[model samples]
Target: MLNGHEEQEGVNKFEEKDGNSKNYDESDATVDRHRKILHTDNLKLQDEYQRLQQQNNKLQLLLAEYFQRKKCESRFSDECTDEEKERCYHNTLAKLKELQEECVDQKAHFEDQLKKLQEERQKTEDMVETELEIFVVYKREILLQTMKRHGGKRVSLEDLDRLQQVEERREKELARVQLENIKLNMRFSKYQEKFKAHSIGVDGQHLIDYEELKMENHTYNEKIEEQKEALQKVKKKISSTTHTLTQVKEKLEFIKAENLVKRGSLMKLEAHVNEKKEALKNLKQSRDSLWLDVKCLRCKSGLLRNVDLLQDFEDHCDSNDALKEKLDYLKMRYVQLTQNCREFRRKVQYAKQT
Candidate 1:
């Protein structure tokens, strides 16, 4: 019977050794798997770091280009013609487009990385859960042993202190992350508001330009009508001049007939008296003075017509100058309005961020 008990004891010892070997094998395998995962995480982190470095380099380059453009624009602002200004705006628009595309790409990349990281975190958590379960069972056994030895005492003081420290650390990390998120949200809101105000200002400026153009068109139509009226007045003046010329010709013909008859009479009277000859010469001189008066009237009428035309031209020039001044004022106002809108937008964005 003693040998039988000894043999049973030996069998029990061997079974215990087998159980320990199985536990050690599982523990080693789990540890190896965790190590492999950690190595993979390290490699991924390195790759991400390199990508971030590249992005930073690109950002720096973009900033440098922006500064260069600004400098160039500042130097040229006073001298820039309409076409040059347009070219500068076009270049800026193109750059904005490129930036938008880059932002989209970066957003996509970040989302993808986030997804990958979440998946890895989930897997890691699962592994941790399994390990924790094993540890919990081991700890339960140890706790039971400790309770038995110490008459139901609780956990060690050191362990409690460590747990409190861990909790505090986690709380701090969460708070930090939340604060960062709040800041980002605020900034995003600010930017959005700024963009809205800018857009509204642009719309308002466009409306003003449209109104100005309509007014300009109306003024041009009025000018055209005035020009037509002036042309009609000129035509009327020409017709009156033609009629006067015809009357002058008729008067000249009549004077010639009268002179011929008078001369014949004078020839008959010449045999009677020299006094009658002096009276005939005086009448011829009066006829010559009357012709000079007619010529002077025609010259005076031509000078009046020229003066009227010149006055009309001066009036048109004055109107043009007034229109140009109004246009310049409108343009200046539009620019100011746009600037104000931009500032409003920036403020709104800042408010939203806050």
Candidate 2:
């Protein structure tokens, strides 16, 4: 009775092991299905990452092309950079400053020359007045001498003639002094008019030119600012693209780690399942051999009424058939899942292309 009880316990333990192995097999199949799904998802993510990279490259190329076009089209900045703009502005400012300085210098030069001319005119007028005083003194002396010689009597015609000749000479000297004064006044007037006209025309024209330069510079600055804004927008787009790519890469890494773990677990489960199958096969073979030996003994002894061994063996065979059916169902489900994943990938690709 104890032997039969121990044998029954062993059968129960074997059934429990078989049931546990069946559960493990089912769980492993589910894990494998999930792993495949994850693998497919990882592939999709990689494809998306590649597409984003391509888009980023295209954006970069477009940005480069735009910058090249701007450079070719621009007239202000040489390199289209901020420093270039500043340098150009400085050069323009320097030119304006030089022009202003030149105008100031010219005005100063004109003023100095005018002051010298005025001083010379004043000197000439003083010299003319002194010469006239000397001429009057000489005439008075000659008349006093004539009066002394005649002694208040009638004067000689010859003496009167001499006075007339001296008078003529003094009048000629006065006329020459007046002519030089007139010429000096005319020259001063001409210079003053020329200075006035030059200042008006040159200053006005320079001021107009400077204003035009400023307006052109203003327009150039506006264009530069607009280009800068455009560059900033492109940079933002590139940054966003890079950020998305980084996220995808992280996701791919996570998927790879998960795949490694799942692969390890699947291998372990497969090893366990194979061990269980070997054990079951060995047990079935031993049981069948024992059953044959017992039948041979019973037939030889003429005691062929025992059918428990055959019935027990048939029950174990039926259990194995049920397990095989379950395995087949799981495999069919895995195949369906793989098909579904493939279809999903195809749909995604089609959508992206459209």
lDDT of 1 at 247: 62
- Report lDDT per candidate: 0.60, 0.56
TM for candidate 2 is 0.24
Candidate 2 regions exceeding 4 Å error are 1-221, 294-354
Q: Give each model a TM-score.
A: 0.34, 0.24
Q: Could you list the CA RMSD of all candidates, in the order they appear?
A: 66.0, 57.5
lDDT of 2 by residue, 1-354 (tens): 124345345345434543454554455455455545544544454444444444444544454555566566676545578887679669856865785676567557755755665565455555545544554454344343334333443453455445546555544554454444444434444333433333433567656655665565566556556655655655565566457446644654464455456556666777898999999999999999999998888788652464776778789999999999999999999999999999999999999999
* Candidate 1 lDDT tens digits, 117-143: 768867876786677567545534433
